[model samples]
Target: MAKIAFILLCHKDPDAVINQAQSLTAVGDCMSIHFDARAPRAQFDTIRDALKTNPNVTFATRRVKCGWGEWSLVQATLHALHAAVAQFPDATHFYMLSGDCMAIKPAQYVHDFLDRRDVDHIESFDYLTSDWIKTGWREERLVYRHWFNERTQKKRFYAMFELQKRLGLTRAIPGDITVMIGSQWWCLRRQTVESILEFRKQRPDVMRFFRTTWIPDETFFQTLVRHLVPERDIDSRTLTFLMFTDYGMPVTFHNDHYDLLLSQDFLFARKISAEAHDLRRRLGVLYACEGARFRISNEGRSLFTFLTGKGRTGHRFAPRFWETESTLGRERDLLIVLCRKWHVARRLVDCIRTSTGLPCIGYLFNDESCALPDLGGIQDSMDKRHRHRRALLRMLYEHYDSDRLLICLDPSNLDLIEDFCRDRSVTRLLEIDCDFSDRDLIEHAMRVGLAGDGTPPETLARLLPTIRNDMALETDTLRDRNFAHHSRLREADPPARNARAIAAFLDCSEPIAGALATTDQLFAE
Candidate 1:
């Protein structure tokens, strides 16, 4: 009979909080919830009235105005923890959770699991030695005093930090306490919770010191639990299943993640989106009905493993069936066309489409306009287009059923151009040199204004050598472009030489070659 007490800290979304509180009460667990003082009074009253009839639910007497990356979060947690402990004396375990968290496992299963293991389940690691703090200030987090809210008042925060640095103001951690860093979520046994409360009561100076430290909610309880509990008695892992993006933001669970949630052995999951009504209802039903019968499947675990590994390596694209086809052999048909002038590139793509009757797309990576009607949504932002460039190419490659797929790219897109040149899947790269000199480009930009958005002189100067080097490493499919010779030849007879080059690169049949050769007017400057 291991009864559990839950300490829920919430700021917004009263409906979600009420649902979670009701779910826990239905399972016979007592909970104390603390709403942020900054939240709307109506929201707090709504949640309180919704669960007022349930004797297992209690609201904290003290509410704190919480801010992100501040000490008020810890204050809120402490308030709720104190209320829960005082109200539910028979509870054997105390769990800290957010308003967005929901139980993914049966109450009996959780109770039995805790009954078997007498250790506290929390994520605690030595910050100095561990690689957990990936991209932020590590030692500086503790040594520097962060008086301002880093999220809301970033300018003031950085200003104060710099002033402190220049003035040689630094704080030292107490010699008696070892600073440990971990997630804010934890599940502690009654004895561990009691010890932590007692420690907090006795150590006022330490708490005051941490009040100025960065994100004390994550480090406060984590450092104390390690000081109180022995190494063998702690699990050093959170009972809540959580995942974060590369930017360190939590990934919200949605309806599509139902199968993924079933695979996890953790008793609860957090940061569940408010819009995920179906997912929440289904998980609640499963928790109530299935209980221990809900078995973990290998499919979910395998998918999670693949997603996690791929996410780490920056392969964030969703795997498609055509991607499998690409691995088999479909990649050989891929062809990339590079040119500085969009109109010339468009003419070349048209010629290729007429000659080969294959899927030839024009300006696939163009920031302004794309040939594909369906790609309008992704063409709005240059950064987004660059990020999803590979995935878009793959989708187009699979969209049109043909032996060859041709894509037109502007040489100004050096990043994508480099990727295309190095890609083994791209069997051919046709670089059509329109022979526009730096003076010609500048004059054109001046005449046409923004319409002639050609590459700048400095960029073109840097781009030409890089392209030559990249083309040198490429296979024979990339024909050598002697710019000087091409310039001399184009000065003599521009249309004929350009037509011959296009026909030669495509390896067109006799009839198509004749059609392309006569279409010399399309190559006129």
Candidate 2:
């Protein structure tokens, strides 16, 4: 088979991409990469070093900012494509790839698909025909995002839908605002890629639109291919969709279908077990693993999507997926508890053994519940004596007695944690004060799934702690337009000199944090 070129777009994905590159190399594909120029030089240096050992790998000297709804990412792709064409002029086919995508099918199948492919058969070009622009489409399509944000999105959506409807789009008798997924992963015959690049050189307008469109890469590649060759051998149905509802890897069971896909090198998947031995133990699984990726469990895979990079794409491939027969059976889970809020329960819980020396898990809901949605309209006035205890329920059944859980607490909500520890068989509880670690909002934004709606002083307390800066507790809240003021314990405010620390050891802004002392400025003893 002639050589296939892999164009991998990435940022902070060295490990996964490198591993997949290992697989591709084993299967024999020449690789080129475009690392985001926006990343600090250190990242590129590391990536270049990691792949320096690969003979067929080429690194781009030109890097660009890969914006989400902007033309930047498109420019980078074209630039890389130009570079890849120069280096591998003899390469027969080009496969656009991403750090997150792994090829589970045998290379021969892909090679065969490309060998029969013609230069005319691609999606992106035909959409650019002379008739296309006459349909009131030009660089305006690049500004499609104006239809996405603030003022004009709703109007633009209906207008565009009406226009497409007016165009007699066959895919929908009604109108479905459909666009190809993305060129983050696509395959093109070498001649076709060359022609597209040549076309790009000739038509500055086409190229400009590609550069500025919110989703340029996908549109450029797919639109051209579809435009030029609507009759191409695109296996739209052959593309498989996988969802890993299990843990690590599939339980080995001999079945002919599985064997056939493995033998023929087609994509078929089974259930797997996903487990992490270090800090948390997520044993067994509730679903199946399709590819060597995707970690699925009883919690299903939605909550774990971001952690594992499961995008909106319909196809899935979890190479490490497996199935488990639960002795526990199909049962619903209930409740979660936080163990550092209540002092009555806090005194009963050995605060020495939680948080620092121990892994004290916690939950807190303070300030107000006016924000929470309710099922029964249950409230302080809903029951007798105007009392309805509204609260969040957290359940912890798997208890590790020997392991200590140091719980950092919010002073105002101390009762929640203390009560939880008292009810559960906890080995020990060490409560620490807050530290207020909010300086790194870049990473925080992604982990917390912020709506990006410009809500100030957003309460991100529920976000996973792995990515959270402990700063929920401190900062000047006396008056700020971004967020409302919180109680002292939640703000990481330092205690008065000679004042007792009320929360976790790291609670104070500076000095000794979470050090236990009485209100008298001395040990209770």
Who wins the lDDT comparison?
1
Span of 10 residues, lowest total lDDT, candidate 1: 482-491
Encode model 2's per-residue lDDT on 134-233: one tens digit a residue. 3344544543322242233557655765675577532311122123333234566776677777877776756544553444554666755544444444
Candidates in order have lDDT scores of 0.72, 0.42
**Which stretches of model 2 miss by more than 4 angstroms?**
116-184, 229-525
Q: Each candidate: RMSD to true structure?
A: 17.9, 20.6
lDDT of 1 at 390: 59
| Model 2: residue 382 alpha-carbon error in angstroms | 45
lDDT at 512 for candidate 2? 31
Please report how far candidate 2 places residue 388 from its true position, in Å.
44
Candidate 1 lDDT at 128 equals 84
| Per-residue lDDT of model 1, residues 216-294, tens digit only | 9879989889999999999999989887765677878898776556556688998788899998887776555534554
Model 2, 257: alpha-carbon shift in Å? 16
Worst 10-residue lDDT window, candidate 2: 278-287
